[model samples]
Target: MTYTFTCKKVPLSDSVKEYAQKRIDKLGRYFQDDPAVHVSFSVEREVLCAVEITIRSGSTILRSQSQAVDGDMRGAIDSGVAYIERQILKNKTRLAKRLRSEGFPSVVEDVSFAVKEEAEFDIVRTKHVPVKPMTAEEAILQMNLIGHGFFIFRNASDNAVSIVYRRNNGGYGLILADDME
Candidate 1:
């Protein structure tokens, strides 16, 4: 996979970069095509290191981020990669369908799992609303006006369904649906 690294208020050494490349290269086995991997490293108060990794193939994206205490960059990187791996494992079937629909080769193989107890959430309520076409700004406005945490609508620009949500950090985030073949 191709890698692009960015450092925020932190300098990366050649050895660190090489280490990161080696670590991320191991993930290439999961993709038929080499995906673009973007990695960002940041330092917080000189005591913590944050690592963000994003893998992009066509319109699908898998991302993970982690912060390591005591400024351990390697640990942060490892944690981020593990998170992505877990995500892929959890959604392997869904990802395979998406890949095939998008004309991409499937990279996951079926594996038997040992039964284990897992937490479950009961559905308490369900509400359905007609998705209206609107710009992202309009969706954000509607979400704020309704005092709702998120609003769903069809994106005017792409004619695809989209979601606008209020972020915990006092900002809005947009999730656009990618057109698949």
Candidate 2:
């Protein structure tokens, strides 16, 4: 796998770079094709060292970030890689399903990880609601009136489906679905 490293507010040493590359290269065993991996190192509050790793393969993206309490970049890198591995393990079955159903290129190798029995997720409730065409502002108002965190509606301007939700930062976020083509 190819690795691109970036440093922010911290001086990257040759040894640190080599260490990170070697550690991240171990993940290549899980993929059938080499994925592009980007790692960013940064120092926060002049004490905490942070590392963020992003792996991109075809249309799938895997990302994880970790901070070192002891200000060790290597530790942060290790933690980030471990987090990514856990994410891969947790979503292995879902990814395989997507590969079969959507025809997406498989980044993972079938032989690398053991396939374990996955817990079933049951859908207990189903609700059918009319998707009303409305502006984004009107959707937000409706969401607030209904005391719900999010409201899904058809955008009046484009007649496309959209979702408006209240953000944790006391703001609003809108998700508009567009054609990939």
Candidate 3:
């Protein structure tokens, strides 16, 4: 497995890298084959310690981003590790439910449980709307005018299909769709 660390805006010392490496190795037991792991540490305006870990195994991806309580990198790494572990555990539970009627006696050492959920979404209604070209602001405005959570439209800037949604906390989020190679 390859572990890559990206330090943004702050020069991470050797001690910090060593600390992060240990934390990352703790999660390595979950992968069967070599997986690509990317860890990024950054400092944002509101967030003191910004640590994000992304693990890519085959076609599956597990990511966790954590912020420390008081700009503590170790604490942030710990929290991120815990969060990703929980995610893995959750996926394992779901996969186990489908794999066997009875649960496993020990903790699973595989992370591919998240590869295929196998579960299907309950779809009751489907709608087809005309995708008109518009700017991000216009999409947000359309979403608000319709009192909908999200609005889908073609982007005027790039002519790509995009979605704009109202975030739970605040502000709006734009999702741009790209072609698959």
Model 3: ten consecutive residues of lowest lDDT: 96-105
Q: After superposition, how far is residue 113 of candidate 2 from its true place, in Å?
A: 15
Overall local distance difference test of candidate 3: 0.79
Question: Which one is best on lDDT?
Answer: 2
Model 2 lDDT, full chain set: 0.82
RMSD of each: 5.8, 6.1, 5.8
Of 1 and 2, the candidate ranking higher by lDDT: 2
Tens digit of lDDT per residue, candidate 1, span 77-128? Answer: 8888878766666656566554433432244345333222233546999999
Sorted by lDDT (best first), the order is 2, 1, 3
Q: Estimate each model's TM-score.
A: 0.69, 0.61, 0.67
Least well predicted 10-residue stretch by lDDT in candidate 1: 111-120
Clash totals for all models, in order? 0, 0, 0
- Runs off by more than 4 Å, candidate 2: 97-118, 121-181
Across 1-181, the per-residue lDDT of candidate 2 in tens digits comes to 8889999999988999999999988777656667899999999889999999999876677898899976799999988988877666666667654323333324446545443435766899999989999999999999999999999999999999999999864899999997652
The pairs that clash in candidate 2 are none
Candidate 3 segments whose C-alpha is farther than 4 A from its true place:
45-47, 93-130, 147-149, 156-159, 165-173, 179-181
What's the alpha carbon RMSD for model 3? 5.8
Worst 10 residues of 2 by lDDT: 97-106
Whole-model lDDT per candidate: 0.80, 0.82, 0.79
